[model samples]
Target: MASFSEREQAFENKFKHDAELRFKIIMRRNKLVGLWAAGLLGHTGDKAEEYAKSAVESDFEKPGHDDVIAKLMADFQAAKQEMSEHRLLKQMEEMLDEAQRQITAE
Candidate 1:
């Protein structure tokens, strides 16, 4: 049987792992979506990387990915790029899986 301290340590370890995983997943997802949006907006090379970082930063504007989506949608519209919200949502879902796989592999 584990003592109280041992059980507490195990719980702390699990919490830390979970938090780190969540952070990695969100960051990876943001990078993937940023790259996709950059491509749509004709950004390449360093410009695309900068845009990707912006995407990651946008996520901090609010809870969840609402801010990111809003920013991308507005940018698309402003750039006269035609992209349905549904398509963006789909890409987000796909990117999430890719992000999970990427973090798992790292």
Candidate 2:
């Protein structure tokens, strides 16, 4: 078995890496949200930032695209919306799984 300090250091490293990953995920999500809001609301740079903030703060009530995934893939060369949605969902799953692992490890 690893010594206490060794285990502690490993845990700290894992936590830090996970946090960095989460930060990147949030930043990426913010960009997508900003793009969507700006295009939809006719907002520009700073205004888009404001819209993004507001959207992030509130419950974003956009319609789910689950039903249209197959159509989107068939119609578009690149399944953009589907890929972004998948990334977002995967990040959420990873974060939740990481939390569970941490809880169990403790």
Candidate 3:
């Protein structure tokens, strides 16, 4: 049987792994959403990739996903794109599921 310390260590490792996975999923979701937004904003190829990177980085500015939403909304407005916040939120949710699937497949 495993000792207490071993069990504790296992739990800690699991927690760390879960946190890392969560971070990866969130970043992937941001990238996916960013790419979607980039396409809508007339960006393509390298520009779209760069925009996706910017969206991933925006998550670091805040604890939650608000920063990302704000950035995307501002960009949409600046580009004269018509995107509703509700639609954006729905897309985010869908992208999150896709992110999780991609990560788990790897």
Candidate 4:
């Protein structure tokens, strides 16, 4: 039997672990989406990877995912690519699932 303090500590550890995992999943999703967008914008190889990193960094600008979406929207518009916010959001959702699966598998 664990003491109360031990149980509390275990719970805290689990919470921290879950938070870290969630962050990783979100970042991975951002990278995946960035790659997808990069392809549409005519970036390839190292440029694509750099764009993906920028996508991950964009999330740090604000608390939620809006900053990322804004960046992507601006980029698409600048490149004269046709992309709707709805479609981009749907892509984010799909990428999120892929990110989770990838993280869990590793």
**TM-score for each predicted model, relative to the true structure:** 0.94, 0.42, 0.97, 0.97
Model 3, runs deviating above 4 Å? none
lDDT per residue for candidate 2 within 11-77, as digits (tens), equals: 9999998888755554445445444535545678888777556544333333332323332233232
In model 1, what is the error at residue 5, expressed in angstroms? 2.4
What pairs collide in candidate 4?
none
TM-score of 2: 0.42
Per-model clash counts, in order, read 0, 0, 0, 0
lDDT of 4 by residue, 1-106 (tens): 4698899999999999999999999999999999999999999999999999999999999999999999999999999999999999999999999999999999
* Residue 97 in candidate 3, Cα distance off native in Å: 0.2
Quote the lDDT for 86 in model 1.
95
Ten-residue segment with the worst summed lDDT in candidate 4? Answer: 1-10
What is the Å distance of residue 94 in model 3 from its true position? 0.2
Candidate 3 minimal-lDDT segment of 10 residues: 1-10
Estimate the lDDT of model 3: 0.98
On residues 12-98, what C-alpha lDDT tens digit does candidate 1 reach at each position?
A: 999999999999998899999999999999999999999999999999999999999999999999999999989999999999999
Query: Any runs in candidate 4 off by more than 4 Å, and if so which?
Result: none
lDDT of 3 by residue, 1-106 (tens): 4698899999999999999999999999999999999999999999999999999999999899999999999999998899999999999999999999999999
Better of 2 and 3 by lDDT: 3
